[model samples]
Target: MYHIRASILFCGITFVFNFVRADYLTIKEERSYADPPTGDWVTNGVITPLDQEMRNFYIRNADGVIEVLLNEDVQIGLQTRVQRGGFEERKVEFTIGGKRFSYDLPKNLYVKRMFKDAEAVRKWEERGRRPIMDGKLYLKPIADHLPTPEQPWISGKFIRENGRFIDVQIGREIFQIGTQGHDGQHRFMGLLGQKDIKPFIQQAFVHGKLRGDVFHASELCLRMLEDSKAQDDPKLGRYLFIGDSISGNYDKALRTALKGKLNIYHPPTNCGPVRKGVENIAVVRRMTNRGLVGM
Candidate 1:
């Protein structure tokens, strides 16, 4: 009876120890990938796959399993490897259905939400100016056409009406462009109606060769300045130039032309690319409120 009881106790203790060890291993595997608490899905950033079979990748969470399909003919691009502290990232790109996509997969099987459209995915791969797709329209960044901060005014949307006219909406302003033009030249209207802007438009035309749209924008700015001056606004005399080395040259030329008529303010350091302006817009707005104009 003593031998029988001793054997039974030994088996029970071994079973309990094995069960605890298995539980620890399971928790450790899940923690290694920084996985969300059982059921949550990653909303953004790199998406790592838990497992892959042929062209289908399966992601298993507490809620259910999600399967991503990558066809065989998809062309994969070069991989980028990044390492920071204890974390490691490997990003891969592939093109499918004429659209390119990219995602980063970690060794521990952690991932983020994938791109919803090709344009959003393409923006990440290309540098400098690129077209952005919003619904049915493909719009260019404002900085690509004008010397303005590239964030706020990101191109325009066009709506076709009656098969003869197209209405273009840029920010809050709308303009009508006809499908037909005189002598094969397109006609642009609705931009020349402001009375205060006419003088600046004439001035810009007399000075040099300038694009019609750019001249219109400059005239609009001038009109704003005139209005502010008329109201004795404190921001009327101040200006801020936010750009790179080339813009510095333009700033110097403008300063010489103004000749103490306006106070020009720019960073003592290089401002880099248009992206820097997009990133620090909040700081720019604060400075503008403090009496800086056209920042």
Candidate 2:
């Protein structure tokens, strides 16, 4: 029943800043329901260029633009990989400029796809639409070093177990999951915790590497369970809109634009106008009635 989660991150606002430059640093705060009416996360973002390097970037908040810098390494192209999936490709690919780039090391990559193109997705639709993940998902890390992806399969929540605050029976254990392929530098960043991890004893995952009789936990994924919805927090809101071909034409773009924050659902067939709506709406209504989706 444990679902995977993600590490802390946030949304961005666009603007050009003359002073201070870096790649990314944005903070967003939500209603901390755990802390109730008065509980709100106050945030300020700061990014330092590590030993690896630095880049010119702009930061922002509700008021205006903010940028912080640390190191002297602006990648000639882009540091993060831009993965692309399409009809022609059998697997999703990172937009590695040319075949030659520095720091090209092996990475853990996991993706639930048979291929990258529309045809592959269409073929999948013919089936049950279940997840079509690659076989070697999170088996182990290629590099046996500290801060490896697979080593930190850890998370937990505290409950009164026997007599102590042992989270033997806790919520989702699937935080910070990832995968890697042997052939390429492609890595898959699966799930991450919503917040920065705390100490191992309290709100973090209380597990570790199997060495002798001791457990060694280098990093931990932190989580706060919701009362009504168990440990899972549905971050995005799903909305259904019925319309003609116009809506259908822009459907993909709309979804792409609002990728992570919200999801927009539509019927299989376009509902068209009022008279058309009457017929198609019934199908949609049946779908909704059966707990498929809602308005």
Candidate 3:
């Protein structure tokens, strides 16, 4: 049996990873949390819903460095396993996804550090493999040349640090940042006057072109609709989404707003109107009955 055992030692942490014998691609991710009891760790990914309720994965590596996986591919991008050990000590038994990643180690350095190096990650992925190193920030650089002059764009980081909004510019654009608390408007609206009623337009004017990040939600929604429509009809191309809005709940309100704009953005002259709703799939049935079928 060929095995590679690596250990990383850090302040208040010690981690060990072992490649055990297995047929399936076995990748294990283990970490210790930073609470009083000290070594609370959890493993989660897209392949399986997290056994725990927390959305953010914050666990310390055996070497004490914070392990962070920013994208979805880390989970469903590759399937892995989890093995829990003693407090502050865990074992990950797995193999690289595709090719065998063998590197001559630099003497006297931590084995975990060598294995977790970015270069190693690049090499491993080059062969269509997945490495099981989690808990480190992954920042892909912005290209020196951006979109053409015709396509004016802006991008920045919206960080809410220490009760203050900080907009870190990314090359040319500045973004707005803010946070909201739970205590706000709530009422029965039971015994209200007739004048209090206004037609809910569900209007949302999303300025997606302002900066690259601003229009992501709108862009994604449109993309999904287009993909679905294209699947339904191959010859006809992509599409757009119209919505209606309620100022109360952003989630449901956005859908309502999108519903209203369907005819405007995707006029009869172009692609027909498409409404993708979350509340239920029945909305599409209603639209079809109204004679607004996809062209």
* Top model number, TM-score: 2
**Poorest 10 consecutive residues by lDDT, candidate 2:** 1-10
Q: Rank the candidates by TM-score, best first.
A: 2, 1, 3
Evaluated with lDDT, which candidate comes out highest?
A: 1
Per lDDT, what order, best first?
A: 1, 2, 3
Cα error, residue 282 of model 2, in Å, equals: 4.2
Give stretches of model 1 more than 4 Å off.
1-236, 246-248, 281-289
The runs of at least 3 residues in candidate 3 whose Cα sits more than 4 Å from the true structure, single-residue gaps closed, are 1-149, 161-166, 171-218, 222-282, 285-295
Candidate 3 lDDT over 1-295, as tens digits, reads 3343323221213334443322222223222222111122332111111124322122211222122222222211111222222101322232331222222211111101112234444554466532222111112222322222332222233222222222333356533222111221111111122222111101111101112211111100000011123223334322232223321223343335545343212211111122122111112212222332322
What C-alpha lDDT, on a 0 to 100 scale, does residue 98 get in candidate 1? 33
| Model 3 residue-pair collision total | 21
lDDT of 3 at 236: 38
lDDT of 2 at 7: 17
Better of 2 and 3 by TM-score: 2
